[model samples]
Target: MSEQNLSSLTNIPSTEVAHENYLLAKLILEIQQTPDEYLPNLLQIVRLFRESVTMKPVSSDAWVKAMDGIKNPHPVKKAVQQIALSELLRKWEEDGDEEEQTETAEILCQNLEENPVSI
Candidate 1:
């Protein structure tokens, strides 16, 4: 995978992606069921699917930058960066919830304005 674009590799057309949607979900469940020793490999596969779905290009740019900043480079930054990236991906997934909450808040504001609370 060196020098290969992971995002492009998993970028299936939307039509084809629809067909694989269920398969992808099932694969996620299977990965959970898979034994511990095999998880690292399975996770890499999951990362590919995540990149494809998010349409975000995944790269080691953050890790590379972190390493460059360190006077004594260690592979620990790689692990740290991966964890940071995973948390970021989770945030991206949850971003839709913010929109829903904003809408609900606006509706509440409208209701409150129409029926102002009396002290």
Candidate 2:
């Protein structure tokens, strides 16, 4: 990725950042649990998922497409994707980190104060 693209990845919306962090962390856990034979593929999937989520106009559609791209002939790959989707849904349904929630609110407030949006 170019430097500009790398910079854009870091500039994801705060709401998306939390989701990305949670997913990445969970992927790390999954990667560790995975057998050596499947580790590389799982890692690649995680990388692709991260890239998809960081794209401009972030949406779940990117994630769904990435998940779908994995070949279905391999049951392990499908299982891993299912697990990731389940974890993502679980995270979204639950109340997230309170500190992160507060930090996001603060950032929003600061942005609003700095650049008031005209009606």
Candidate 3:
């Protein structure tokens, strides 16, 4: 008599599958015991769960296609940019020690020298 290969044996149930089965059983029991008025709310939650489980992720191409209609995706007005820079300077001026304040001011001056704002 010859021995069969171990590889030919059927796959055993995984812990994840067993956990899912247990959760489903618990949910079924809860649904049965739930009050009549709350059953509708529970069913809605179940429907939402089902939808979430089946929902597929949007692809990059899909995202590009969806956004193609917009002319300016992120338009930053000149006034808004100026206001942001002023607000940043105001915040730096209000807080920090003298040494730290001087360091920040130097850094800001270096950045402005590197990249001069047109507006």
- Best candidate (score: TM-score): 3
User: Tens-digit lDDT track for model 3 on 1-119?
Assistant: 11122121212234544766555555565575689999889989989999999999999998787676343333466567678988987887887678998998899889989987554
The TM-score of predicted model 3 comes to 0.37
**Predicted structure 3: lDDT:** 0.67
| Clash tally for model 1 | 0
Residue 21 error for model 1, in Å?
14
- Predicted candidate 1 versus true structure: per-residue lDDT over 1-119, tens digit per residue: 32133334345564656656645644555555699998888889879988889885546997678666664445677568768966875775677587775786688689879976332
lDDT of 2 at 63: 68
- Candidate 2, residue 40: Cα displacement in angstroms equals 1.0
Superposition TM-score, candidate 2 onto the true structure: 0.27
Summarize candidate 2's per-residue lDDT along 10-86 as a digit string, tens digits. Answer: 56665767876645555455555679998788879879998998979747997677666643336776677768966
Question: Candidate 2 — worst ten consecutive residues by lDDT sum?
Answer: 1-10
Off by over 4 Å in 3: 1-17, 65-119
Ranking by TM-score: 3, 2, 1
> Which regions in candidate 2 have their CA more than 4 angstroms from the true location?
1-26, 58-119
